[model samples]
Target: MPEKFVVVGAGPVGSLAALYAAVRGYHVELYELRPDLRDPATTPLNFTKSINLAISERGVNSLRQTGLTTLVKDVVSSTTPMKGRMLHLRKQGKYVREAQLYDARGKNLLALDRTSLNKTLLDALESMPNVKLFFHHKVVGVDFNKKLAWFERRTPSDPSSRGTEIEISFDFMIGADGAHSAVRYHLMKFTPVAYQQEYIDKLWCQFHVAPSPKDGKYRLPPNYLHIWPQDEAMFIALPNQDQTFTSTLFLTRQGFSDLDAHPDRLVAYFQDKFPAVVPDLIPADELVKQYNENPHLPLITIKCTPYHFSSSGVIVGDAAHAMVPFYGQGMNAGLEDVRVLFDFLDQYPTDRAKALDQYSKVRTPDAHTINDLALRNYREMASDVKSPLYLLRKKIEETLDVYFPGLGFATQYSRVTFSNMPYSEVQRRAAWQARVLNCAVGGLGVGVLGAMWVWGRGGGWARVKRGVLLGCCWIARGVVGVVRGWE
Candidate 1:
């Protein structure tokens, strides 16, 4: 008989995991705390999640590896391709927009609705004969030694009223539950898992920018993620397939509280900070209505070690590492986790225990790295995007990447979004690139200064300019040689 694989939390990660297991001929049972999302009457369990998300190479690659040829294509068809970020700001008392491409190579990220993506994965899983989905079932407890799990079936009519608990036996269990995961809570009892969770001071609220009434098309540019950076607070929007945009306002808790206290000042605040949004893209009245209606949710970051307990159970997605959404990699990383875990399983098909052990050992650091990067990206999105120095560095990096492709030049964003490289390795390589760029700039500056001093003694203005150009070229060659050596 094939091994019975039980998966808790039928979110995208769990659903994908179940699909992978079913493909491997395992009898899979996927459990979820919420009802099937495909039903129109089912209330969404946002759990502080954004309505839309960015799907990058990491996530796309994971779906492709499932052996479902049409899955990736189908999912991508429903998404809008955002090539870069579009900054909305005021200059010289007039609102203006600036475009910042994510990659020099014209790579793009798919802007997709969270529900649509989840439904696609769930639909794919439902078609598998070996996979059974148990919705409205919450994981209550687990016994790793005995390979057993307990779940409470929640009634839709009265969610507070719980029905009978059911006990199920399985050969292995996978936990892809969200931040407040019951499976992770139970796993802690079996093993000494070191866990850390942090709630950032920032809170986010959703807003909708409807399509234009005149033409029934997008009010803002639909090819880029729109961002209005206001230092301590930022507003962002991602295009949807229906010519509308799902926007979010991120601010500190105190800022949210202050705004909540003064409801009338909200529109005026938007007019001052994000002038282009108010009265044009989203009218003041509609903006205030959406703000008053949507919930202001806090951001949470979670990091845990030893995602698996012996050979019986393992956790993926937010259960393993819940990160802030600023990096746009939360879902991608979670989906990538399924691929990585299954790759290990394929490697050690005979010894499941060893495969899981090796997975936990290798994945923990990468998970932590992305978590930290997501946290750091909050500052980048909120303020750094507007900084002249930041833009200069980005331009220089992109120029180098375009000119010297053989040196393995790439921006951190490109590496994270356009490639499936390990998160830890990406960070390390990005740091190395930063050091090389700094060294190159410092060398060029010193060379120029020395040339100026030499030219001051006897050389004329024309000679000084010629010498400066020669010095720049020499330093550029030196930097390229050094980078090649490192490579």
Candidate 2:
């Protein structure tokens, strides 16, 4: 008989894990605390408002590994391509827009609704004969030694009422539950799990920008993720399949509280900070209504060590590392976890415990690296995007990448989003690249200064000019040689 694999949380990561296990001939049972999201009446978990997600190469690659080519094609067809970020701001008393491409190579991120993605994955899983999905079942406890789990099954008709508990025996358990994962809570009981969770001061609320009434088309450009960046706050919108935009406003908790106290000032605040989003995109009354109706939820970052408990259980996705959404990699990283985990499983098919142990040892660093990057990106999105120094650095990096492709030059954003390289490696490479760029620029500056001093000392113009030219050549050669050495 095949090993019995039980997966907790039927979200995208869990569903994909189940699919992977089922495809490998494991009898899989997937459990979820909420009702099936495929039903229109099912309410989503409250941790996050349904902000549209960006599907980058990491996520796309994970799905492709599942061998669900048709599903991948369908997902790609349903998503809108976001080629860049469009900044909306006021310049010289007039509202203006600036576009910043995400990659110099013209790669793009696909905008997708999380619900739609989850439904697609669940649908694929449902078709598998060995896969079974159990909804409205919450994981109450786990026993890694006995390879068993207990779940409290609530009545679908009356979820508030008490319900019976069910005990399940499994050869292994995979947890992809969200930030407040019950499986994670129980896993801590079985091992010396080092866990850290932080709630950022920022809170996010969802808003909508309906399609234009005149033509029923998108009011903003549909090919870009729109951003309004203030120093301490930001508003962003992602295009949806329906021609509408799923927008979010991120602010500090105190800022949210202040807005809640004076709801009337909300419109004025938008007009001042995000002038382009007011009556032009979302009507005043409609914006206020959406703000009042939607919840302002906090962002949490979670990091835990030893994601596995011997051979019997492991955690993936948010259960292992829940990051802030600023990098747009929260889901992508989670999906990638499934792929990486199974790669280990495939390597040690005979000894599942060793595969899981190796996976934890390797995946923990990458997970933590991305989590830190995501947190740092919040500052970049909120303010640094508009900084002249930041843009200049970005331009210099892209120029180097274009001119010196052999040097393995790439921007941090390109490396993180456009490639499936390990997150820790990406971070290390980006840091080294930054140092090289700075040194090269400094060398060039010194060369120019020396040439100017020679000219001031009455060195002939011809000699001075030659000196400057030689300095340029020397710096260029030095940069090339250094980068090649690293490679």
Task: Compare the candidates by lDDT and give the number of the best one.
Answer: 2
Q: Please report the candidate that would top TM-score against the real structure.
A: 2
Error of 1 at 60 (Å): 0.4
Which parts of model 2 are misplaced by more than 4 Å?
A: 45-48, 461-484
Each model's total of backbone clashes: 0, 0
Q: Tens digit of lDDT per residue, candidate 1, span 1-487?
A: 9999999988788888998898899999999888888888877767325647899999999999999999999999999999999999888888889999999989999998888888999998889898888988878889999998888888888767888899999999999988998989999999999999999999999988899999999998899999999989999999999999888999999999999999989999998988688888899889988899889988899999999888899999999999999999999999999999999999999998899999999999999999999999988987999899999998987887899887767889889999999999999888878777776777678668867886878877777777677667756865775557544
In candidate 2, the residue pairs with backbone N, CA or C atoms under 3 Å apart (3 or more residues apart, or in different chains) clash, namely: none
Q: What are the lDDT scores of the predictions, listed in order? A: 0.89, 0.90
**Lowest lDDT block of 10, candidate 2:** 43-52
Candidate 2 similarity to native, TM-score: 0.96
lDDT value for model 2? 0.90
What TM-score, computed on C-alpha atoms, does each candidate reach? 0.95, 0.96
Runs in model 1 with CA error above 4 Å?
A: 47-51, 454-487
